[model samples]
Target: MGVVPTDNELTGTVRSLRTSNSGLGIPKLLATLLSSQPEWSVSEKRLRKVIQRLKSEEETNFHPTSSLNSALDVSKYSNKLKPILFGPEKGKGLVATQDIDAGEVLWREDPFVYAPPWEIYEAQMAGTASWQDETRSNLTKGKGTSNKLGDESPLSKDAIWDTYRSFATLRNDQRWSHTSENDLARSQLENTFRRLHTVLINALYLQHSESQEDVTFDSTNTGSIPAPSRSAAHTKQLKRLLRVPIPEATLNSLFSWDGLMEGLGKMSLNLEAHGGLFPLHSHLNHACRPNVSIRHISPDGSTNSILHSPNPSRITVIAASLIPAGVELVVSYVDPSLDLRSRRRELRAWDFGICQCGRCLEEENSNSNTEHPEISGNRTKIEGGDERDVGQLEDELRGFLSV
Candidate 1:
């Protein structure tokens, strides 16, 4: 019987609370949200649930390892790897709980979702146009088209395609504002955004299959559109971002683009370029000389005898070296054989930071020094020799260094 907060209002309230310097508790956060929307008859209990959900969502993005580890535990499959908080600067990372020898399996997980290349989506779009034209013609002629595959399920192809249309229509709100200098950049981003949108839609549909709750919508809550699941929150956020109306439930639910962008960014930085979204494997940080190596084995269970069982396809993380108990587990983000400059440049450009591993430190120092330990003995011998020998040695040193 009262006005409920709009999706925009709810999103704004959560953002405000998160950005505030003061650590406001549940009581204060609820009070702040209520105060911001006094016209709404939001009960304390209902508001608390909303606040908690948003906070938890924020925490999952900021500290990804917690959620990843929790998923691992819930699976009930014995995993040797554990997630560890490496402080605010480093974020969350993985560590070994026991000593692991080379070639021993540490952890194996199926990707939460995998996104195919953009070309597939482009082809699908071209195909859909012809179908739409036929549908329009049938409607104009007062004819109803029959759905021969009449399953009418929530995850039906028709429902998924409808959701995909809504998702794809939304613009890339993250793109730069219109300007002369940004014209070309914006043009390029259109294709990039479309590619991302396609992948996000597919991933969201896959994630929805894992949701346990039923979808419920409020009919008379004035100005309010509720999105029940975290997955729904994701789609609702994207709808809000593009100033689109809140999505209505189709086949009992709607897909979200909310965490898709953030998840993609994390995947880019943490996962191997060859890999897609392996949630558990992505948590392991980078090291110049990593103790772990990932092996991509076929689902048919070929090559490795350990993977002879009928498990789903997975990228197995095996110990590359003997890792001691409580040691941090890491893998190289880039080829370690590259020079110090190349390694750091690759990390800075793509991975967002340079490696602080021991191998990196040793290489950096050795590369910076003018004299090498191998050539130090040569210098000492020349100093003790006659002037003629010393001159010849100096010339020879210059030639050797140049080569």
Candidate 2:
């Protein structure tokens, strides 16, 4: 038998219905609400929590995200690189699952995903399914408190824990904001995010002090710039950073953190930090002894988002020097702008172990006074440098040295 609706349920359902009218929310459009399917089989507990959210939302009279809603068409998205080997740690490293040859486009993806309307995330915050119960339970018991639930505690002294939504502050995967789905009768995100947390979230969440809502950026692909969104209290700080990277500037405001040491212990989520065309030059992973290398080729007139290749149409990975198959593949993470030490530091920060690829080892063994004739004046760094220049020069040799 169907369960009878409580007063809260009846009132909440009607209120929820009204907030979603075509004029307010996209989902409320007549064609959508009347013909939608039931939500997927989330647990009953999570479902009731959603009901509670409806009641809360109904009471708050929260306005829809009209600004974000009307901008991009909710449907259209590009499938550039459908990401393969995701990072084993906190959204950092990804590897090729299959053997990829030189010059092949290894992987490409839009990398940006649309997030659920702020309403859904807020509901999850208030103890709805996906995140609410999980966050409260985890926080009260203090297990995953690394996500940092300082003032926001559990709904009651006794509550069941759920992990789904708790990860918003815990993980750093850019993909969490993915807006892949165009239409759905039921919520399209719960399952996708659960899977995403697997690929990205870390257990040791580090805390920062930024307001998540105030951060915004322009789409490099679409060229759409947005003014930063911030609470009233942050107006001064935002003004100070008007021209600085809007994203990095807000990192300090992040109120949570990830604790797991990425790439050191367990595998974490690997993600694309920036989206652009990475020529074959971006593919190499160098070892102390290097085998492969990368070089950014800027054709006559290409924008920062696009690059031109020397060989007209196609780009390929090559043995900058003779590379044996058994050696690890390596690339210089920096563009041509980086010096040796700079290159090394960048790789170390990203958690790659010291490169000991074949080429790096060979240079050390040879110990030549001068570089190999083939390498002199070569724009690309075929192999990591040898130890010959390390201790003696120390600080002077910053880029690829001792990193």
User: What are the Cα lDDT values of the candidates?
Assistant: 0.56, 0.36
lDDT by residue (tens digit), candidate 1, 23-53: 8776787777667667766666766677777
List the lowest-lDDT window of 10 residues for candidate 2: 262-271
TM-score, prediction 1: 0.41
TM-score of each: 0.41, 0.24
Model 2, CA-based lDDT: 0.36
Q: Which candidate number has the best TM-score?
A: 1
Residue 132, candidate 2: Cα error in Å is: 30
Report the lDDT tens digits of candidate 2 across residue range 232-305.
66777768778576465355334212222311222211121222343222223334433333222236534232
Query: Number of clashes in every candidate structure?
Result: 2, 59
Candidate 1: C-alpha lDDT? 0.56
